[model samples]
Target: MWSGAAHVVDAMEKWPSSQEPTQTAYGLAHGTDLTFFEHLAGNETKAKHFSDSMTFMQSAPELRHDFVHEYDWSRHARGTVVDVGGSKGAIALKLAENYPNMKIIVQDRAEIITHGPRYANTNIEFQAHDLFTPQPVKGADVYFLRWILHDWPAR
Candidate 1:
């Protein structure tokens, strides 16, 4: 996390007058044309570490509790919950455990999708998807996009 924070700092320092620093900091730190995740996709160890980090963040009890209490799941009884950019389906699994009537779909990049099945059960399903594209699962009762959009700056 510290390294990521450092990267954010570095990116902020390099932020252009009229543009965000994602591409610049990414290129500076990685010396590649690819974005951070794009670079990680080709490396197994880094990819695993990234996924583990996301899982660690999601495993926090208070975070889960806040989400559970804040959202009115009862209103969407027997509905489908699509967890977009869900790293390893951890939150979705938790939701499934609590809301037995609701079905959960965890979607993320292909690199993270492979690890999803390990955490999935009958009530939770995992799909490989890039959130930049149009959502494939139409008419979901809820599309939960937790901590996802900040990765990209508004164009």
Candidate 2:
């Protein structure tokens, strides 16, 4: 697996495949490039792949420090937070640990949350949802959307 990743990295160095392969292929074949969201929207798996990748990416210990100390979570005590597109409830669990009094909703696709732990505690709840539709949970003091914007190009 490591060797395969190295080969991919070497290939990527030669050509930036990681930056929207569909767009690059479209450009090479038709002399026109579509936006990232356009490419993602066309393929249903794009959203799932992107979300899972994000969940895996956040597993690195270094990433924890970046967000943990970056904000003052104490202000949100006794408040409710809804984590949109939250996979595996990692961030929601962290928030629950930080602010025990606050309530949390870990919202993601049913396929992603399938056979996974719903939430870390009683203060948290997991709901399978499609964010493309109207947001189901409301009145949240904070709607956590960590690293979600980069998944889609700005319209």
Candidate 3:
């Protein structure tokens, strides 16, 4: 316990000492002090780390069944679809392969898109873009945003 003149402790010491905690501090400590969404939004390194962590998590069998079967690419013809936040061009490359006649634009953050070894296929094009702002590409028959919206909130 901290000795003081009956709740008249100095302004600096009125709060609990940082090293340990009183009951109130202990109770509050159990709750999260930081907003998880805000933290993830601001921390680019954390976002990239998380994205990379999920890199190998995609399985071919799963992609074939879940993604390929889920959509009918034949509906759209003779145009490009921009893949927003299309990291490493995985989905874009797959779409390009499936829809050989259609061009695929894989857009992602400058940090992710600027590095070496982007997609080599002529059908796929890579551009540095930030999704927080308005999209750059236009007039596409389709705009793909696979697994990207949830990264930020709906609002």
Candidate 4:
């Protein structure tokens, strides 16, 4: 996180004269063309650390409570909710625990999906999906994209 923040600092320093104001911080930090996840993907340790960090963040009670109360999930009680990029299905599990009638599908990358069955609740299904491609599960009630967009450079 600190490294990413430092990258933001570096990116800001270069931002003033640049044509693209929202250039990626990771690109500036590493002086490379690869994005942050692309770099992490090539490094096993960093990828594991990143996954662990996300798990830690999702475990926070305040974050879970905010997610639960902020949305009107009752409207989709009988519908399917596809949580796109939902790593480990933490939010989906919480929603399943709260609403028995709703079916939640947590979709993430193949690496994450391999371990999904072990961690995910029985009520919450896990699927391997790349968010950049078209959504496989069609006509779902909600396609939740929680904390996913910030990874890319702003357009």
Q: TM-score of every model?
A: 0.83, 0.63, 0.62, 0.78
User: Which tens-of-lDDT digit does each residue in 1-155 have in candidate 2?
Assistant: 12234355444554564555344433343333564334444555754575556667777777654565588877888988888878767787777877889888888767666634665346888888877789877778888887666655455
Task: Please report, as a residue range, the 10-residue window in candidate 4 with the lowest summed lDDT.
Answer: 15-24
Residues 1-155, candidate 1, lDDT per residue (tens digit)? 34455465666666645254335555566666677788778987788888888778776766545677687888766999999998887788778878888988899999889854565345888899999899999999999999888777677
| lDDT, candidate 1, at 69 | 66
- Candidate 2 regions exceeding 4 Å error are 1-56
Q: Against the true structure, whose lDDT is highest? A: 1
lDDT of 1: 0.77
User: Per-model C-alpha lDDT, please?
Assistant: 0.77, 0.66, 0.60, 0.75
Residues 1-155, model 3: lDDT tens digits: 02222333432354544322222222233332333323334557755654564454454456433565588877764687888877767677667777788888888766566551365555888898877788778788888887776544344
For model 2, which pairs clash? none
Give model 3 RMSD, 1 decimal. 12.0
Per-residue C-alpha lDDT of model 4 across residues 1-155, encoded as one tens digit per residue: 45657677667776654444236576666666666666766766666677667777877766545677788999998899999988877788778878888989889877766654454335688888888798899999999998898665455
- Write out the backbone clash pairs for model 1: none
